[model samples]
Target: MKKLLLLSISLIISGCASFGEGVTTAFLNKQKEKDLRECRVDGKSFGGMQGNYDGSNNLLKVLMVHGVGTHIPGYSTQFQEKLAAELGLDEMSSHYKEIKLVNKEYPDQDLGVLRVRRLLDQEQDEEMLFYELTWSSITNPQKEKLAYDTSGEYSFRRAEVNQMLKVFSNDTSPDPMIYLGKHSQDVILASFRTAFCWMMGRDWDALPNESQELCTVGQTAVEHLPDEDFAIISHSLGSRIVMDGMKSMASRVSKAQEGEPTSTEAAFITDFQKKRTPFYLMSNQLPLLDEAAIAEKNSASLKFKV
Candidate 1:
């Protein structure tokens, strides 16, 4: 019953036009001129990408993580272009590097994809690497239970608006629920983890091009961690993923520090502590989701200390 309620809420919240705009159209239009769609940001403000590309050989990297919907590799193209223009980066690579993220331990599992593009200023003095992580494929199999409902056999019987709502619900409502399941969240986190490694470890030329691979925190990442800047842009469930992923990373580092931390782990932890990696969340959903268990009392602090 609780799950059903959450699903219903998700359906309503996930941009069902009829349920949303339909009911509010008259009032919205009446007050549209007077209504203030204010964006209230509550947190410490950090300088955005502008400061990251200081022409110092340090690369500015941003990763885009989508929330609870199916998305393709090129989903961030338009946003990337706009961001590039805002950053005064007019030149972009003709091709993007694609990686089919897979965990070596679970080779059969489809962890989703990482698409990378390089953006440069007109003079080529400043550069940014844009990484787009499409992890919807992780929860897709679970959502397929509703696939038959969307078929003409069943969808034809519903009212047009109802059908659209049902399809929207089918596509999005199950993601949070699936992430709550046994290992689904783990798989999604692995997808995020690999993307982070790829973002930190290599430049545009070093990344694999159109290949299936797993990324590990290696020497390259340890060496580059000090010089490069990293940030994340996420929406919806992605905010939760980034939060949890950072906590998980902190847990590993904390545990390693307990005994004897390896050189790579030590370097990563030390360098990570020095840098401020900001997360820009759109339609952030961390408040709506259940919090994961954290063994450390200050795990949240540890997560952000980096």
Candidate 2:
């Protein structure tokens, strides 16, 4: 289930070079929210705080993308702490901040939930921002559990597992890889959408209540700190997800550049490319994914404008 799914998604993404076309394919051919923006729709906290932070771009910003399996808030913080320690940085605890995508556990039947534990340390020309991204909430096995009045309680428990599969039949069981297999396109997209939202630096705690597809909303906020290097750290199966996300982002930039006067998407991606966003594939599937991960490029079938 996992291997097949990965191959399908990878080919669609790494194979495409146009944003307008790649996103649809990158999503495994899903088209529910193609027009959605990565940032907030409102202007209040629009550009995130990036609009004000005129800091140097010498910082090493990491967008840590996690692989499959069940994980929680602590997962993000621990990652940042360990990395800081490896870098010989002290006072790790003081630099941690626990944040949720919607500021609540089991965030109101959302497809995927993201919580970033931002670790910030800056010293003039040297700075480091580790934004640990976790998408386990939507990729867990507990989602298969259906609620059926345990202890005859109705107004005493919280709501959960309403994403992906809305109805739980009597004879059906939830597949573990539903996150990667069919019936999970939205779940995967939610992860991509949320990551973009955070990268764009939106006030996610202020996410609107009626917003079902908040992942599809848009705001041209700073996806990354200006002049800073953006590198992704992927682990386990998360490597494929990172590849898909970056490819989609790159294709989107290409499409945006085709606009009458270019686009914010183009500008945003171009900046990151200029920064040479590095992919640290720390996943365990490096051996298994090497061949399939080989990016395919079509160069000879192109024409130049005169």
Candidate 3:
């Protein structure tokens, strides 16, 4: 009897363990499927080549911009490819290329090369949209060490992207470029200009002087967008740059409205007060501007910290 009882207990324990393992495996499989679904491509290629253009059938254009420490062909490539597929443009290839470092422009100054592609259909008369996406590396050495052990850094990146997207989707205007960040401002600007030229089918030199200017960079790039609505995704310090540019642009417009054609500098100040442009900032812990100035000029701006 004792032996039989022991045998029964062993059998029960083994059955429970088997069941637990099976449940765990099933859960893991589901997670894998979810990840794959997020990354899966769904559209057909536009051209015989590996590039995507706004084919005659497509109506909307989306431009993606990358943030600091990221460039074309990096993780931004994957995200753009996935986004294109999701938007039913699987045939369309990514429009932006990575920035390459050629040589130092001067001592301590790095000159970078930027490559950008246009993922639009030339035959289509679609409205263009911009999507800017960026990520930041923790600056604090101690924080960086802690970030590795905890997935906080990666989680923040994903959260920032999602939050930006939510605001983009809410916008009533047409979609525009999505900007991501990587280190090197010149590279970022170069890539942006290249992408704009490709999308517009215009020469690089034909771009407006205002568009090429550092302070007017974002506005200049977005102004080239075929659509009126624009979405910006900026992280860390990149957010400051975007905000400052917007404020400057707003100041310019305001100045122009006031009939003050004083100078480019004066126009920027005028525009800042006249325009009610919509902007969304994500995970921005640092204050980029005078809090009082921003509050006065851009009271309508939405900020999300994650």
Which candidate leads the pack in TM-score? 1
In model 1, state the lDDT of residue 263: 83
Measured on C-alpha atoms, candidate 2 has an lDDT of 0.52
- lDDT digits (tens) for residues 1-306 of candidate 1: 999999999888876876677779877778767756798979977667787765475478899999987887899999999999899999999999999887775789898889999999888888889999999988887788889999999988999999999999889888887887659878888888878878887888888788886678888889988878788999998999999898877787778878788888888888887877888889986756755333223354665534
User: What C-alpha lDDT does candidate 1 achieve relative to the native structure?
Assistant: 0.84
**What's the residue-level lDDT of 136 in candidate 3?**
20
Deviating ranges (above 4 Å) for candidate 2: 1-56, 93-111, 118-125, 141-176, 200-226, 259-263, 286-306
Give the RMSD in angstroms, all C-alphas superposed, for model 1: 11.6
- Clashing pairs in model 1, backbone N/Cα/C closer than 3 A: none
User: Candidate 1, 54: how far from true, in Å?
Assistant: 4.2
Tell me model 3's lDDT, rounded to 2 decimals. 0.40
How many clashes does the backbone of model 2 have?
7
TM-scores for all candidates? Answer: 0.80, 0.51, 0.39
Report lDDT per candidate. 0.84, 0.52, 0.40
Q: After superposition, how far is residue 148 of candidate 1 from its true place, in Å?
A: 1.5
- Residue pairs clashing in model 2 are 19-251, 19-252, 36-216, 37-217, 37-218, 57-227, 236-283
lDDT winner between 1 and 2, please give it: 1
Instruction: Summarize candidate 3's per-residue lDDT along 80-183 as a digit string, tens digits.
Output: 56654554443443343333322222223332233333344344333233333222211122123333423555446566767555434333111111122133
Candidate ranking under lDDT, highest first, comes to 1, 2, 3
